[model samples]
Target: MQNSYPNRQWIYVKRPEGRVGPEHYELREEVLVGNLAANEVIVRASIISVDPYIRIQQHERNTYDVPHPLGIVQRAGVVGQVVASASPLFAEGDWVSTYSGWQLYARCHHSELTKLDPSVAPVSTALGVLGMPGRTAWFGLMDAGRPRPGDTLVVSGAAGAVGSLVAQFGKRAGCRVVGIAGGPDKCKFLTDTLKLDEAVDYRAYSTLESLSDAIQAATGGVDVYFDNVGGRVTDAVIPLIKRRARIVICGAISQYDGGLDKPDLGPRFLQHMLFQRATIQGILARDFINRMDEMVATVAPWVRSGELHFHETYVDGFDELPAALNSLFDGRNLGKLLVRV
Candidate 1:
């Protein structure tokens, strides 16, 4: 390794207004001139996740790590291999994944990482199915939503990373699965690929009325609804929920474009929960990390046996991460979105 390194990164250009575009972020190049400190290691990124939180925050508001101010490198989760190490557990050739955000190389404290076991799980799994998004699905379904046999489970953004896995996991628990997505291809994926009991295309339906009608037909009535996209989708389904239903608020990709606004039939739906004795809870997966081993155990065998399916769209190269993520916001990709470093 060289004594000095040059790293290229994506920087926040300005605070976004409404619909975010390329102009919101700027690709900046910087030179890194350093060596590892005693408890630190240097890693070259292998894969990075293009997630919603990166776009939701202002140039000054970060979700996982600290925010990246305007004209500065952005923060995101990354999977990498250590090229040089000064820590006891991490050594040269060690492969691990972390919350490095969006950068080509990382110099971080060794205590901040867990060594990746390539023999047990594929390296890319750290970014998608076997990692954060997968964990989010597992934690949300089991703890918050708690679907059971014969229960009707509905997941919004059903073809997405967290949504796809949540639907599959709910299926494994013996609940009937219904998915909602933006396009026909994604709708097909929920049925043909993920094998959920039913799928609804939000675009074809147009209004909240049609979407509610389609979901009503699929679920009969949902016992649990895993909400990833908020806006109209939530408005469409909330009133149709079964008595004593549970709603897990995961990510609101729908509302992230702009914070909450008055809804079409918004004020009317909260009474449905009260009348039916249902529960609605918002979740952040990190709150359940202590159960990581349990999540791994729950999904690992299914992953190996091909019983549980994880779908991801990979865009190679460190440079391709952002645009790949933009595709997600535009509903252009299905399943989990991943970047191959």
Candidate 2:
């Protein structure tokens, strides 16, 4: 067996001013020796994930967690296969998911890995629908949004990863689901593919008032708002809340560029909360990590029987990691954005 293997990694080198792309990362190659401590395994990355939260962590100041420290492999989730192992729990050719970031190869302790069974679902789904995004969508909507039968649920960033799932789940809960996305193509996906009741294209309207009007027309009045792209879209959704509405703050991809450090405040929709007696909650996937088995058990059956649809936008090659992440902000992806390594 080879004692060492050549590996490629994307290192976060610089903070972004507006948009995060190749300029902020450094791609370097190194050799990894096969020596491992007890309970350690070497895995070769097969798929890597690019998520919006990565940009949030890039902010200089802390938000939900501390800022991502500079000069490290850009943090991400990876689905890979074990090539060598020193742990009883893992073996060569076993598939696993790990927080091994942007590296093509990583030596990880068995504890840091979650063994994946290809027979269950696609291993790449570990980085997507069956993974963090799924957890966020499930808990954020069911627990926080609390959609009921015949309720109007409005989802921003509806064509994207978490938003798409939230829209479908809202439909499953017997709600009237309206999806708000960037362009006509994504809107089409929301209505035609995901089968949402209505799909609004936020980009068509140049002002908040116009966007708000569009959403109001589609939803009539919102009983639940699942927000992923904040800013103007959020401003638009707030006033449309019906009595006892619930708002689940899942993400704010619109402001992730630089607004987290210096926010751009919008309309004071807090008055809407007062009028409607609505509940607003900010949910993170980490909060529901303990209940992962509950989510998988409930949602995995839908995945296996094709009762749920998972759309994946794949960017071929590990080298496309930074670019794929940047494309997220541009609304270039349909569902989960992934890099096939």
Model number with the top lDDT: 2
lDDT tens readout by residue for model 1, 205-246? 877788789889888998999999987889889988888999
Global lDDT for candidate 2?
0.93
In order, candidate lDDTs are: 0.81, 0.93
Clashing pairs in 1: 46-341, 75-101, 76-101
Q: Candidate 2 on 1-341: residue-level lDDT in tens? A: 35687999999989897899999999999999989889999999999999999999998877888988889999999999999899999999999999999998999999999999999999988988899999999999999998899999999999999999999999999999999998999999999999999999999999988989999999899999999988999998999899999999999999999888888988787888999999999999999999999999999999999989999999999888898899999987899999998
User: Cα RMSD (Å) between model 1 and the true structure?
Assistant: 2.3
Residue 302 lDDT (model 2) = 95
